[model samples]
Target chain A: MSSRIDTKTKILDAAEKLFAERGFSETSLRLITSKAEVNLASVNYHFGSKRELIRAVLARYLDLFMPAASNAIAELQQQHPHASLTDIFSALVSPLLTLNSIRAGGTRTFLQLLGRGYIESQGHLRWFITSHYGEHLQSFVTAVQASVPTIPRADIFWRLHFTLGTVVFTMASADALIDIAAADFDEKNNIETVIRKVIPYIASGVAVSA
Target chain B: MSSRIDTKTKILDAAEKLFAERGFSETSLRLITSKAEVNLASVNYHFGSKRELIRAVLARYLDLFMPAASNAIAELQQQHPHASLTDIFSALVSPLLTLNSIRAGGTRTFLQLLGRGYIESQGHLRWFITSHYGEHLQSFVTAVQASVPTIPRADIFWRLHFTLGTVVFTMASADALIDIAAADFDEKNNIETVIRKVIPYIASGVAVSA
Candidate 1:
């Protein structure tokens, strides 16, 4: 990458890591600039303000996620013209599961960022997410409703909510939970195992009647 | 209440509101003390540290939640000696739904605090929650497994993970989602509606097989 692009990437990298660890308000611009090895002026020049910098950090992550998710959904729809609810659901979530596999440390960081976004309410990232991805979520909800006409629309929304919570939590808190429940469970970092384990539970919940 | 006890209560009330609005890190001891109309020395003398003050805020909320949830579960177990999986599921969740009915601002604050704890990570409140509520979760899982024998234990764990995410998100961000979707629907603040809407989706997700 050119020096200009490298600076932008470095700012994003430092911002994402710090945002994930300390959240938006707690993290200082100085910390991000120091970590990125760029002058303070670069952040303001590239992103305008710390708030915009936070938005940029989240946008970079989402830009990577949205295309992959949209393509996976499109491909699945084509492959299974008469796909069951489970099939569509799998398409929607499987891409996220595979995100970690696309690169080293990518999945862990993504999951961490996601969990932080959902759990922390006061961050600028929250506004960015709702504004950018709210429509995408509505689209997913519409597709699921179309696939499973029997399920109530309200229930569909709620199940989607729960499914997200579970996915983000498992990704972010798995290591800690594992430490707490130290039993005969395998210690593998298999993302597939996580996906397979969660999909059914979410599927069953969404499929069941109130 | 005695003057001393009243002052302590005021401090807690202010702290909870501030923490919920600005987060634990961004909200300062000075802000909290001033909001409570107590002196800086009072905060130091009463709570010893800001960290402990945060814990006290959470502990007060959980103290209300834990007993109600436990009682509801106990009542359910007694009422139906052979309750189906759905009944068991309702027993576990219904009490939490009722938490919204607690005094006007209480539920929102509680939800905010819970969301903050889950997302922020590395806190005494998080430790307090997992240690106290971990077994309750495990037992609920066992009931779920017994009811749905076909599902694997690992899958149940994953579904639970999703269920938690959904619940927290809905409780914390429902207003935001409602605002965003205001054109499509009326904004109502009924917690029962939320519970009724969510239960079946989550139940089906957990019960259905892949």
Candidate 2:
């Protein structure tokens, strides 16, 4: 049982790294097996297929992130029922940053995986996330809606999506943007700094009156 | 001469459609040739390579958009002398929508292509746009800076990128979102309506106090 779990983990680690660095469709299962140093049979045994492996890789992060983010928001709402949009968004930061503790660059990796998943896999990943974590996502959306009651739910819907686009696209290209920012502005930044920078922008955008 | 131009336009039309619908890396010269009903030699003759073809496809829209957007901003500055950030952002709406006049579904296609280009090509498309249309971009950035004099340049840089991500990601997935909105919220949104919806969100985000 331990050995089986070890093989599963080995496949996931190699898969996630490749998926994040390259992309889903571009990263083949053969390369993943080679990187994991496990044969084809091992991947098949562990994850059933490449698609399942992709889901598993993402689930690893989402499993950790969703509950933590939900808990953080829940805690914030309990403490400060009238929390501002920025405050609500800021609450997610700690949960997001804690991802780095799970792996060397877990936060960045998870986000990139997310961006890639959404962009590459058509609606499969979206369906997977929503079906699995609908309640958690709903909680976050509900908190934003509660903060801005005046905005219609539909407009809130659109704006929240806009906010998602901001974070998703930003995280997808975070590494390149970081390198460029460092070269052009002499500003050395990591994933945390970039995440912090985006919160205000998204918070403000989500709360803006339509 | 006319036949050559026709063949080139034929290739571009087919290439853009496939590239936007699928993606840059997913669409191949052979597929584009098959869709265009032209030979591979024609694409090679016209664009030199797939990378160049992608650039050409984007450049077609940018050539029209960059100047029109700049001129719109220039006109806004000339007329108002102190246009607000919303007004500055709103100025580009006409230019963006004007893309439709050039082709059916052109606005969405151009935006989708831009999103795909940025996401797929790593830094190549970014480099192409900046190098080719640097002045136009700088002017828009300068106008934005003028509106938000209080915000730091670096903050503006970050926010503008946030804004780009918002627009890019939103448009990339606009078709799906529109479908969902129609089904769930009963909101019928075309590309124009979506663009208008995002303008306020981005304008507010761009000008928000740091």
lDDT per residue (tens digit) for residues A1-210 in model 1: 335658888898888888766666578999998988889899989889886776676676687787677677667667876667677767856666565665565666677667665555453556667578876655666667877788766556556666666676666665555554345354454545566666667666666766
TM-score of each: 0.83, 0.93
In order, candidate lDDTs are: 0.68, 0.89
For residue B10, what is the lDDT in candidate 1?
A: 87
Candidate 2: tens digits of C-alpha lDDT, residues B1-210: 334558899999899999988887778899999888889999989889998999999999999999999999999999998899999999999999999999998899999899777777766888889999999999999999999899988888889999999998888888889999999899999989998999889988888876
- Quality of candidate 1's docking, in CAPRI categories? medium
* 10 residues in a row with least lDDT, candidate 1 chain A: A180-189
Q: For residue B114, what is the lDDT in candidate 2? A: 90
